[model samples]
Target: MGYNFSRFTRGIAPGSRIFAADGEPLSNDMLRAAVPSIFATEAHESRSARFAPVPTVTVLDGLRAEGFEPFSAVQARTRAEGFEPFSAVQARTRVEGKAEFTKHMVRLRHRSLTNTTGDSFEIVLVNANDGTSAYQMIPGFFRFVCENGLMTGETFSEVKVRHSGNAIGEVIEGAYRVLEDAPLVAEQVASWKAITLQDGERLALAESAHILRFPKADQDGEAPAPVQPEALLRPRRSADRATDLWTAFNVVQENTLKGGLTGRVRNAEGRLQRRTTREVAGIDQNRSLNRALWLLTQRMAELKSA
Candidate 1:
């Protein structure tokens, strides 16, 4: 059973790994059995001031350029073994200045979908040492999830596992651009494991030049929205052009968008250019979900004029 907290106590204490899958307390033995080795000798560091993630662009946009794909893992079952590629939902992401990133181990269950019935599992991101400010990813977390005693394919990205619960995640296939995808292991009892980057992955990304790169996230309207005209997708085969354009535009935004710790605060001359819209036209939902918030404000004026 999970521990009942006192009114004086605010929340679940770290190391209190109660299985959100059920009410059972996740024991240390269970944790070790899932991941035999634990993060040991991890250097101590102070917490970075909390900052809400800007949006999904942090990983999505970057991965997309690297041929990354996303899916809603728990929402539908037709693609249980894969991704649905639709059923879009709002994206939430933020970044703080130079926060220390940590690696985490995940426990997985495969047939839990059939025998269990509901969501398979969720991703919990908290301090591996002491849990706090837990952030949720989505249907799942971690680049790799163990299924029925075997590891699923890996996601082409690695993120600071945030949150304290769990979510579903889709397995991604890609070149060894992401270190996690490398066929190397670091199981030294004294060392933390990490994936090494492959040379081909490096060359592929190096060839994909940045169309729009911003040092910091300027309010969307602060600068004119840069326009692209099939420069990247010119040789494109075929798909929903609108969705393509939208996703493409997101490609631009994700690649270009910067967040809080961006920009220089020199004297008063270089103050960030912040803009507020009174009325504008054609600000339809042409880009990605991450742009929704920015689009909302921009559209306020265009909508009024419409």
Candidate 2:
């Protein structure tokens, strides 16, 4: 699936329309009309005591002051029986020519808009009323080709702050640092581009990834079932077919995220059954898998350098 950065870009456009796709200014009126929970107060009552309320519009205003525009915004749809399926809203409304739709997560890309290679820096802020997750800010690169939000660093690289006073300042500052460090990311990508991968090394990385995706059985249990490493290494796009470590890593990463590669596994009845692999969709799993692939490539490059 192509990851559309249009959702990230629409918010930052010069004439942003964050409320309706019809091109209107993003305002409290629009937000409240579209999603009432954003403006809900204790007077409306009944939120869990643990709900650290971060008023969404307030944060957007702060971002605007700092020159960061909202491109996409969505409300967390209640899984409660009646309402239609909803997702975490993207952070901005649409301007005349911007993208459309909603999600609960608000994304703000760096205003500087410097492209390190084909990727631009972005920060995603996730807020939830259901107590399932904390309000947190994530830093990542938005790849133009595939529209993938490639996260940097480890799973815990996110900066989590309470919704209380100055959270916006902390978020802006954290994002500033993340964008400023884009050079480091560029350096690593450059190194990977320079490092060629031997067939053996590439296969080894693929084998490790297969294990990560499908772990071996417990010590006392039967031996783990087998899966072809090539299944995981297959390139999903033509651009990923090169022999360098960077290309290998991108191939693996895209395949992992895109899934659908088939493998045989033991069913509950101990019969071998062909099953399609699941896409890496959850926030935690995407981070873990992407970071693991990146680290694997980094290690290979380091070894090659030495």
Candidate 3:
């Protein structure tokens, strides 16, 4: 599904709407309004009898009992246009009861970790009742400076629980497993902060990110990147102007994901037209890009240390 990001709006990705609270736990009413799928009581009809249904609210309640409170919730909409019959059928199946089975993500923070300043760890929960997704727990960082949510690299293990018997128990277990790695994420951030990158190194990272965002042409050929790599290096705020690897990563990440960079692209008629990059809106796209960027930064840090 294509996703669109709206910085000025409540929605984060296209086909998705997000509600986040500022240092406060989101209420049931808030989550229901933003991502009703989280409150789903049953699985979609498409799922086979073998597919055990576990409501996300069950997991949320389980986490709450463990002192974790959800602050952000988002759900994917099943609306789409398809030309093929099979595609149309799939779309219909997804939309039939999408409100009860669509993919949703919730971000929660443990009460014990609340006092930490600068950046705080969040347990990002992703699930769907339509058999499209399993219970996924990923380590996320909430940056106070930019109000950005960042997923950590693969070095920080992601816990997943398949839709089956005892899934809720497994998910609750996985949440704490992810929580245990919070300090390690903080250590990684501190190390990145300490490693200052020269302008060339920063540019190299941006160039790599540019390629990730806009790949080279295939046999069919594609337009060049909408913006130069240097554009990604531009800081949104003074706090992000530092030359450290962490700051540089944030600069590239924000620019790449939030987009809105003005540039020229060749039209079908071969004329240059002004275009602005779109925000990374798809949940899968967002997570994939965020994780890839994190991996790139990790590799850069490793190379620098070596």
State which candidate has the highest TM-score. 3
* TM-score of model number 1: 0.21
Question: Which structure is stronger by TM-score: 1 or 3?
Answer: 3
What is the TM-score of each predicted model, taking all chains together?
0.21, 0.68, 0.89
Assess candidate 1 and give its lDDT: 0.23
Q: List lDDT for all candidates, in order.
A: 0.23, 0.55, 0.77
Over 37-96, each residue of candidate 3 has an lDDT whose tens digit, in order, gives 898888888889889877999889889989999877767645545422222212122465
> Which model is ahead, 1 or 2, in terms of lDDT?
2
- What value of lDDT does candidate 3 attain over all alpha carbons? 0.77
Off by over 4 Å in 3: 1-16, 80-95, 216-220, 268-270
Cα deviation of 170, candidate 3, in Å: 0.7
Q: After best superposition, candidate 2 residue 245: deviation in angstroms?
A: 1.7
After the best TM-score superposition of candidate 1, give how far the Cα of residue 27 lies from its true spot, in angstroms: 18
lDDT string, candidate 1, 124-241, tens digits? 1212222222222212212111111111112223244342222112211211223342222111100111222233322222123222222122354354323222222222223212
Query: Which scores greater on TM-score, model 2 or model 3?
Result: 3
Query: How displaced is residue 179 in candidate 2, in Å?
Result: 2.1
Model 2: per-residue lDDT, tens digit, 1-306? 112212223212222223234322345565555444444322112345654556556666777777665434434333333323222322332222112122245556656664556766666666543333456666555555554555555523567766456655676666565556666776777778888888889898887777776565433565443447787678767777789887787666666655667878776688998866655434345556666766776777878999
